[model samples]
Target: MTRKEEVFERVEKSILDFDGDKAVEVAKEAINSGVEPVEVIERGVRKALETVGKKYETGELFIIHLAAAGEAANRAINEVLKPEIEKKGEEIHFTGKVLIGTVAGDIHEIGKTIVSAMLLASGFEVTDLGKDVPIETFVREVKEQNPDILGMSALLSTTIPVQKDVIEALQKEGLRDKVKVMVGGAPVTQEWAEEIGADAYGVDAVDAMKKARKLVGA
Candidate 1:
């Protein structure tokens, strides 16, 4: 294989193995060697996550593995994509800026972390509000961040309605029309997202990228 392909394979393997620093090194080297962040993420990060997900479903890997891989890939992508992302220049088209957070009462962040990395790969500037975000925090972030998309994530069925609460808060603040809302979670569905008035539903990190971009018109 070519050097770029080798880097892709190495980075992919590092994420599957949950080797955070190794992934960071491979991703950074891919950049230093002139490989685009988008290419590396599509060919490596997402590819690796797909494998990890399959393994998880089959019990070859567990939730611990999934969480570890997600965190590792997030760090690696952030490190490697920073330079190229900064150099995006002023005139480029973007999928959109996204404000991402896990809703209140949901401390699990694996899904949100993976979603953030994939969005970054797809060229969306993401403001991650971390886990267990309150409705007020989401509204305040929208007012301050002015992002084109508000991405709410929850891992628990009980916490899913917090996304609806955030939507209500945004609606009450008259900011609902200003930005699109996207929802995702273990128990979330398109019907639920629609019921909550979300612009899109993300079934996974890859689906999130496409759905968010489509909603934001990018």
Candidate 2:
């Protein structure tokens, strides 16, 4: 096989093996070997997470496995791939900006963190507001940051209503149409997103990235 193919496989394998250190090593090696940052990310790290997601869906992998892979992928992209791109005199321009937070009453952050990493890797500027964020904070940030997209996540059925409240708050402030709204979490559904007037519902981190891209026409 070609050198590029070999390096790609090596990086991909490191993530699949859930070895964060090795993934970082391989990512740097790929960069030094003239592999493009985007190639290493899309072909290696993202592909590995996609597999991990599938394995989780099939019950072949536990939450720990997915978490480990997510951590490794985040390291590979942020610590290695992104720097390489910047070193190449690229400005790391983002196609869009997103403001994300976990709605009030729900403290779940794993999903939100992963989605932030993935969006960052995919070249979106993300401002994370942390977990159990108040609806007023969302409205405040939306108005202040003027982000291209606003993402709300909730891990509880009760907290899901907070997403609606935030949207309503945006509409009341006349800022609803200025940005696209995306919602997701374990209990969040596409119907719920629509019912809450969200422009998109991300089923997972990857889906969130895709929907964000579509939202910004990227």
Task: Give the top-scoring candidate (lDDT).
Answer: 2
State model 1's lDDT. 0.83
TM of each candidate vs. truth: 0.62, 0.64
After superposing candidate 1 on the true structure, give the runs of residues whose Cα lies further than 4 Å from its correct spot: 90-128, 143-165, 178-218
RMSD of each: 5.2, 4.8
Question: Compared with the true structure, what per-residue lDDT tens digits does model 2 show for residues 111-188?
Answer: 998788667555566778999999899999998989999999999887889999999999999999999999999999
Q: List model 1 lDDT by residue over 120-198, tens digit each.
A: 5455667789999988999999999799999988888889989989999999999999999999989999999989999
Off by over 4 Å in 2: 57-59, 87-99, 109-129, 134-149, 155-161, 168-175, 184-195, 200-218
- How many pairs in model 1 have backbone atoms within 3 A of each other, for residues 3 or more apart or on separate chains, i.e. clashes? 0
lDDT of 2: 0.85
Q: What's the CA RMSD of model 1 in angstroms?
A: 5.2
